[model samples]
Target: MAKYSEKASKKVEQAIHTEKEGKLRTGTGKKVTSRKQAIAIGLSEARKEGAKVPQKKD
Candidate 1:
């Protein structure tokens, strides 16, 4: 597995907390109703910013 940077981890952590509190929202205004979705969003953002390596699908 590839390692995520501290910044990336922090974003994901915040998203997880927000998801747990039912306050997570995506950039397009959609609510993050699932933990997995929130984490995916964070990871995608990190990838976009070049803060973390993206996972390759098998």
Candidate 2:
């Protein structure tokens, strides 16, 4: 796997944790149902925070 910044990893961890707790949600306020979705949400948040995440694919 590609190396991620510490902050980026932390964000993903937090998101996974929240998902496991059944507290993760989407923009439409729908409950999160997939691991990939959670990670994507985490990376999106990290990007918004200007963390050292890799650029998203087009």
Candidate 3:
């Protein structure tokens, strides 16, 4: 896995936890049901916060 900043890792962890608890949601107000989606959501949020995350692979 690529390296992620502490903040980014924390955000992802929080997102995963929320997902496992069935509390995560999407922009369309739909429930999050997949772990991969949750991780993507976390990375997206990390990008928003300017965390030290790598660029998306092509």
The residue pairs that clash in candidate 1, if any, are: none
Q: Model 1, range 1-58, lDDT digits (tens) per residue? A: 6787988998888779888898888889978888889888778777778785557457
Report the lDDT tens digits of candidate 2 across residue range 1-58.
Answer: 6667889999999999999999999999999999999999999999999998888999
Q: Which 10-residue window of candidate 3 scores lowest in summed lDDT?
A: 1-10
- What overall lDDT, based on C-alpha atoms, would model 2 receive against the true structure? 0.94
Candidate 2: the clashing residue pairs are none
lDDT string, candidate 3, 1-58, tens digits: 7889999999999999999999999989899999999999999999999999999888
Report the error of model 2 at residue 30, Å: 0.4
Error of 3 at 28 (Å): 0.8
Question: What local lDDT score does residue 55 receive in model 3, on the 0 to 100 scale?
Answer: 96
What is the C-alpha local distance difference test score of candidate 1?
A: 0.81
Which model scores highest in TM-score?
2
